[model samples]
Target: MHIPDGYLSPQTAGGLWALMVPVWYAAGYKVKKTLSARQAPLVAIAAAFSFVIMMFNLPLPGGTTGHAVGGTIIAIIIGPWAAVIAISVSLTIQALFFGDGGILALGANCFNIGFVLPVTGYYTYRLLSRGAAEDSPRRWFAAGIGAYVGLNLAALITAVEFGLQGDLFKAADGSALYSPYGLSTAIPAMMIPHMAVVGVIEAVMTSLIFVFLLRNNPSLLHSYDGIRAAATGRLQLKPLLIGMALLLVCVPLGLLATGSAWGEWGAEEIQADVGYVPQGMDRYLGRWSGILPDYAFPAAEEADTGEEPAGAVSLEGVKESVPGYMVSGVVGLALVGGLAWFSTRLLTRRSRKKEQLD
Candidate 1:
């Protein structure tokens, strides 16, 4: 869940930011000690995968939408420490470029989707598949189950954050200062769709990719049973790259999703829903409008005509958006993946340096 700006009070957002700075540092140090030079670039691919997979939105029960985060899969392939950096790269790009999430809420978003999902999934897989052979079915499918668990857990944590905002913060008349949804509404609204639909897609996607790589290019993955790493074959990047290209082509499919995600409604939406926009949201929302707002090209203002009718979908808007969505996917992939590659490459290089005192 991409928590927009103003959804949480400044205190909550700042607290999460404080929590993540050290976690991000620790993740980098751990990855530096373990990630080899050859393995670093694959983190880029995994980061790009995380970026693109998030574009495919599936409808939820309450008219909201959800999508799979490839966090668990990335963790499985490159360890949770590296997965943190990889997925963080994707989330940062989405927030900064696409306005998918708020700038102030970036830390909270990363903590939930980037940190919690991967670490939980990675450890869960390790626990379930412990002592199992590399090729064993239990080990093979354990990642899928881990992904399911991890996705739901992340979703629940997001719900709690949204839920708490309403209860803890209020205006003079007791209207919500931030999000209007308390635990009673936020919990069910966010959890039902995630548990039923989104988790299945996450599990299946993770397992199928795991199965394929384990069979064909096991070396691409972080040592599962210490067997895949020692296997004879490695370096089959073509198929994976091809798959990425295919995903970019289909990224526009995300637009089919009809509604904003739960708790992610904008100021206008909040006004319509609750008859008043939360004062905090009115203040801090849209502090940073992204370069490509909503993954669409800025529409050319019509010839002095008044704004189009509310809720009206124009054919031209669709045509313009599809290409913009496709371009946004490419831009996101390049930016996210490039940052991952460079950062990890620098870390890996630093790890290899020997201090020689003259």
Candidate 2:
């Protein structure tokens, strides 16, 4: 759902950017008010986790893939505004380094996934979990459902933005055109499959994590419900560690299961159900460039080992090149995790020493 450059008209992109300015400011203000000294470390960890999670795209049915943005996780730990900042930074890094998303499309992506999902999810969870115990099954369930709702909502927002862009500049009808990418189309295209399965997976994962925190370090979660406060328990590190281990082990199995199904379905389902057939935008879209020379396929030097062109992107290439991806995944995870831990330790230790001296 990361809108690439040229998918949106200049006007649409500019409009979103304008809207984002106030939102970003609001998010910053909220962060200043909400984030405490103790919660700071967790906030950094949330950002790092989000960054790492998105690197692995889960296969969908249409050859296109989706990744966990972890907006809900961030919202759960911090407020939505902080989630926006974290996601924005993570997305910016992804855009800059890997060319996963276009820099020109940054505002739109931030608005849709970062702002829309986390803000809405946090509020919705707050509403549903009202009066529920923090560690209760109900609160966890609400979080899961809230996350699902948030993801679908973000998808809907993206679809509408795309549809509007498709119509505003692509169609002769100056008014909004009736297309498959409309709200109706977007709802089913993005909601149906995600709700059925992805929602459940997210719910289970979120619940497990929530429960782990509840049983272990209750102080880690500042805003737990009233009932949870009653259960004054000592922090148990072993359960949390074991739970995390289980999650790590299960991630691959979940990825394989969802990835295969989603990869097969995404192409046909989206092309058919959410097809935004912009009749006259190809010429315009093709001419646009981004931070990368060409968003779709930026030119790159040859591998120098008698390898294929670096810029070439093909479905067959992906299918035939599973091993390369596996290796990349291993290497990328190690690099990201090492960087996150090292940076966190260095920064925190420096800050702590400064505080002690003061």
**All models: lDDT?**
0.84, 0.56
Which candidate number has the best lDDT?
A: 1
Residue-level lDDT of model 2, residues 169-263, one tens digit each, is 53555533222244555556556656665555555666666666667665555356311232233333354335434434333332232232221
Candidate 1: 10-residue stretch with minimal lDDT: 225-234
**Candidates' RMSD to native:** 3.3, 7.2
TM-score quality measure for candidate 2: 0.68
What are the per-residue Cα lDDT tens digits for candidate 1 across 83-148? 999999999999999999989999999999999999999889889988888888887689999899
Could you say which candidate leads in TM-score?
Answer: 1
In candidate 1, position 258 carries an lDDT of 60
